[model samples]
Target: MSRLGSFAGDKMKTRGRKVRGSAYLAVPFVLLAFVATASTAFAATESTSKTAIFARVTWKVVKPGDAVDFDLQITNGARLGEDPVTYDLKILDLPEGWQEKFFYQGEQVKSLTLKPGESLTVTVEILTAPNSSTGIYQLTFMAYSWMAEYASTQSLSVELREPIREINLVATFPGIVAQVGETVQHSIVIQNRGESGESLRLSALAPEGWSTRFITQDKSEVSSVYLAAGQSITLALETETTDNATPGGYTLTVRASSEDGVVNALMELMIALREKENVSDFDFVSRFPEVTAEAGKSLTYPITLRNLSANDQEIILSVVTAPEKWKTAFKSGDTEVTRITLNPSQSLDLIFQATPPSEVSVGDYSIVVEAESGSTVKQVVFKAKVVGLYKLDVQPSTLYTSVTAGNPLTTTVKVTNSGLSPVTTLSIQVTAPSGWDVSFSPARALSLDPKDSYSFTVTVVPPSNTVAGDYLISVKALSDQYVSDEVQLRVTVEAPTSWALAGVVVAVIAVSLLIFIFKKFSRR
Candidate 1:
């Protein structure tokens, strides 16, 4: 530490003369010169903790003095992506009062500060007392501190492992059915499936006549032990039902424990059991939903396309509609609903919104939405009505005409309310092409009685130098505040010519000549 302070003091004295630049340039210079900044920031983190961490530990009651070790990791929270410092590590699991000792390079470390951005990880040794009891046991790793941040963290865990004397118990009952007053026998198979021999032992759930026995049946049953790894032996279970034995199901658990933990085998006994249930194949077809809607109303429904095959069948479905006026939109979860494929026994549900146009006549319209699955076609029908009790019929479905420039042209428009119904908010508007002035008499609205006829004059004034020839003019007649007809017109304007006055001069000359001739004849 003193050496570092001396080096810093010397550099500070010598560097004081080099600080002549303006302070405004300091931030820019630092921002532009960032090559060593991140490295300097990372070097300030320190890890003060035991190099070896215990991620998981376990103790077994059967082995009384054994423990298991698993792999774990250590980290310096401040600096990541760097190698963790390593040292030999050992864990001690004791029966409450045993002493523990750990060595690193033959020296007992009181507390090793894993250097800046380093972690000491241990995986080589597993320490246990000559006597350790287990159901399960855990060891907490010592806390690690980051000195600069004043933050410390510790992790503790427990893991169940197969001890060196690991044993596996597998038992099975005979036949699928068992009943009272019947001698039902079952066998318990014991195997040392671990890396070491297990000390064997046995116990029975039912005593007396209903009992358990090794093949060499003895009360002190498991007296002969030391079953080697991967070795197997079978024990027998005999039960004689009494007159009062209930008819039901029961479970027998055969357990084998080691210095590590307990492993068990379950034997299920079924009493008064019937035959197993048989399930048929999935051969059901899906039905399309029907829709009924009122006039000027919209209804939405789902069409389910299902796959009823046993094997995965690529079923494709396509949709078609019979009504052009009805607005139909289909959306699947993601993409547009054009064609879809389904897996076996899977169904795709599509929501379809059907909106009926309000302008259709008030008669029942037959609409059909057909879904064509591969090799199968199904139809879903919808009844739509215009509710065409009564409707007003206009002579021209659309108004389209031409008018001279600067002329007010009047045309009779016919409106026939053929329906038993009368509509409101009727208005008329006449529009001309851009750059042409247009207006209509009673420009805002017209109240026409049923089967009414009215003539409205539309004055279209062509601007000076207005392009002569064809231009589109729109005349819109609205019903219920909606545009019902848009009529287009072709208007042509003749270019103003200079010859219009020449004929006046010729007429005047003829008349003057006649007068002069008459005077001369009269004088003679």
Candidate 2:
């Protein structure tokens, strides 16, 4: 019985050892499972923390009365398969009386929702008061997500500066001339040289009995204009004088002002007035009473005619006296007319053309133009001084020649005066191929009278290495008062004599060598 009990105790001990071994093996598995679970929880916490707000530009400089904008982005870092998050937007520490608005996709919104791994862009616009003091301002913007229990905040700074408000008024023409009972127009430009735009009221102060108004490019009359920052506009200022207006210098003041009177611009313009002359029964006026031109060229005189009578009159026009063999006519804009009808206070512009004969002498000639209306007659005298014509001709002895390379060529050219005028200080110029030398004898002529001719000797030499080809040489005659057309001469160049002789010698030597070789080989 003692032996059986000892055996049972040993069996109990073996069973206990087996159970302890199983427990040791299971410990590592449990540890690995716990580690994996904790790691997953940490990853989730890290992803959620990435949900935040970001701003591209948090600081800016702006002028008072200006609007400032900040670009912002809201991101959701929730993992895929996660629910969307909604955020409430708010602005803190903003100045009093300042206006602020939040916009998403160009629409004002107080809150926005973003999907997992999604981002949304938003804008905040702030406007300061016109009279705001110049200083640095700070403001905070927040986006709160209740579901995530997170608040993302961004601080923005803005420096406000003094406002610039300037307007410039300028008159294109500060002075004008006009007669009594007449209206004149001037151009003026309005420019805004400020940081902001404004609506300006325009006014003009003129003398008594004179009216003024501004006209736009579209011809619409306007008393006010709107100008944008750094922009300008042009307008016409028209002034009308009364019938009884006196003849004197008058000053006009033009003004442009804003509604609050903070911005103003003033410009002054001067107007000169002259007295009206009494009207005559018949009037004839000529701006040009005398003219000088070549004998073959025509002369023109501009004449103005007015009839002050209270009735319509039939007028006759004619050239009563002129130089011999000269043709004169009255033209009203390319149409020939000898008679015309004029109403009271009406005027007509006439072109009187006088053409002299080609052989007319160089002297002053008198012309009388007459206009008759019943018993009324008006006459105007004009003078014409005729200068002789000018013409030049150039002639060459030959049009073509041939020469060997490195040889000289000789030719003769004649310059003639074909017209009535005398040509003086006449010279010759030659243009030839490259690497060629040219010269002229008796380089200049003192004078060449009408129908007179002068001869010049021309020499040309080509370079030794000149190519054997056909080339051209141009000769022209020039005077202080005239230039003649260019005359072209063609020249042919031949190879040098030595080159031909050497070629022949080479041929002979080749033939002799072939004969010797044939005779020597036959002996074998």
Each model's TM-score?
0.29, 0.44
lDDT digits (tens) for residues 316-357 of candidate 2:
998889999999999999999899888987889999999997
| lDDT of the candidates, in the order given | 0.49, 0.82
Off by over 4 Å in 1: 1-47, 50-74, 77-136, 141-431, 439-458, 466-472, 478-499, 502-524
Model 2, position 406: C-alpha lDDT score: 93
lDDT of 1 by residue, 1-524 (tens): 34323322342233111112264356446433432432332233213322223344322222434444444444444355543432322232222532334434556543444443555543323344454333333332233332233222222333223355456666665433554555556666778777667665555454224544444444334523457768887766555544455555654444455533454333443335233333322222324355555455676666666667665545333445546677776667645575655677876777666676655544555556655544556666655444433344434333555444554444544445543334565656667667777666665334444445544555677765665577766665666623445656556664444333676788899999999999999999
Query: Model 2 off-target regions past 4 Å?
Result: 1-65, 69-136, 139-179, 184-195, 203-210, 216-222, 230-236, 245-296, 301-304, 308-349, 354-391, 396-411, 419-440, 443-452, 459-524
* Candidate 2 similarity to native, TM-score: 0.44
Backbone clash count for every predicted candidate, in the order shown = 20, 0
Error of 1 at 213 (Å): 41
